[model samples]
Target: MYEIFEQLLSERGVTPYRVAKETGITTATLTSWKQGKYTPKPEKLQKIADYFHVSLDYLMGKNSSLTTCPDCGFTYDPSYPEDIETHIEQHTAWEKAVKEFGEIYSDGVKCEQIKAENRKISHDLSLPLEERCEAQIRVLRCLFSRSLVANSYSLDHVPFDTYVAMMLNNPSYRKNNLEDDLLQALIDKYGTASGMNSGTIYHIPNKSKAISTKDKRDIKRDLDRIMEQLSNQEYGPAAYDGEELSPEAAELFRDELEIALKRLKLINKEKYNPHKNKK
Candidate 1:
């Protein structure tokens, strides 16, 4: 027990004098503990564990395992070679599978959540038509941005201009009068004269600007104001004090705010100080 306790203290670069000073334990008690004169009481053991951010079982040399189970939250003894090896292999495999599944499940959940939010926005007759239209536009923009990222890795996918042209050429898309205007706007922005180009499509509304020091400061100020507005929005009666936007609007606000902040950070790295890499 003393060996393990001493080793832990050494690993943390904490001396007995510092522990005694910080934990309010007397030098006599620490000396007795180090000399193996007697086992510490539960209260004293708890204080030691709390001070060092370790388990009582670890301080007392009862259980040697350092890892806790993610599924069951149980700390298993890894003193035995075979038991520790099998436990590690099983834990690692389970965690890998769970991490992969979680990413796919999270993506599907986000899509479903967006669909539900749009339905709610459309059904709320209290909201003005313009507000509803804006909410839907924000949701579509977010979805389109995600699709662009997903298509970036695929080598066989056609250029974005070609995709837009294909959609515009489709008779079904043409039949939807409302969708035709939106698709036409996209074509005007991204499609080339010949209707085929390798140009990349950017989802952000504003193109890159000359990022001087003053420009970066202005961008930062705008980011701060957006964040403050988002944080001030309340869930109860006070919610009426601020702009009453739907969940989709809040999501779009946060996404755009993040993009602006990242752009500023990149500009600072590439333009302001070319020698240093971004942290």
Candidate 2:
């Protein structure tokens, strides 16, 4: 029992004095236990067990047959030798996944460990469409699971990758989004951020101006909606369109206003690689 106790202390890089301080047990009592002078009462033993997060029986050698995996915190009976081998193998797999790809931490939806590979996969157009979709979903899942959001939460098919990447990298962006309840509570608390107040964001060109977090989040929300509208195969509205001006027909009028800027190449050449002749 003392051996197991010392092993846990060694594994956690803590000392008996620290444990005594934290658990409110006296150093003298620990010394007495160590010197084989006395056994601690069940109540005291339970406190130590709780601190270490192990079963009291295991701590006291009452369950000497049981073994706990240090990495995965899985406890099982070593007496079941055949099953123990299989269980150990499973723990190895999970431990590797957690260390390599990162798991959601307990505090929030922040995936500090979200790998660059996952981010690259989200936007790499050359990959299979399915792969890209999975990458995006995985990123959100990492966020949601880590943050303890429910499984039914919605991102409304928005490019959450954009918001998530920024949120993770930038403290201001993340705080604003959380305070807005922007992406995590997408379905119940509010609809998708992308579909709300979109037109207003377009003209707010001073995005760099100092503003409150909610204001910044609102601007981000509406901009995403604009991108959504342009890319989707649909048109739905006009601010003053009760007349016979169907928006579909109104769209054709855009062509009437379209003109080739013959100076386009001149501007690009002037800026990028001005021709020797200054074409």
> Candidate 2 residues 1-279, lDDT tens each?
678789879866799999999999998998899988988888988898878766677688774465555544445565333335545554664455354444433223134455345657756768765566556556555553332212111122123333344334444434433322223432332223332121111111122222322232334445445434543446654322354345565454333322212233234434553223321
Residue by residue across 200-269, what tens digits does model 1's lDDT show? 2322212232333334344656775765665565543213227665666666776776676767666664
| Model 2 regions lying over 4 Å from their true place | 64-279
TM-score of structure candidate 1:
0.27
Best-fitting candidate, scored by TM-score? 1
Q: What's model 1's lDDT at 229?
A: 66
- Residue 21 of model 2 has an lDDT of 95
Cα displacement (angstroms), candidate 1, residue 88, comes to 19
Whole-model Cα lDDT of every candidate shown, in order? 0.52, 0.48
TM-scores of all predicted structures: 0.27, 0.25
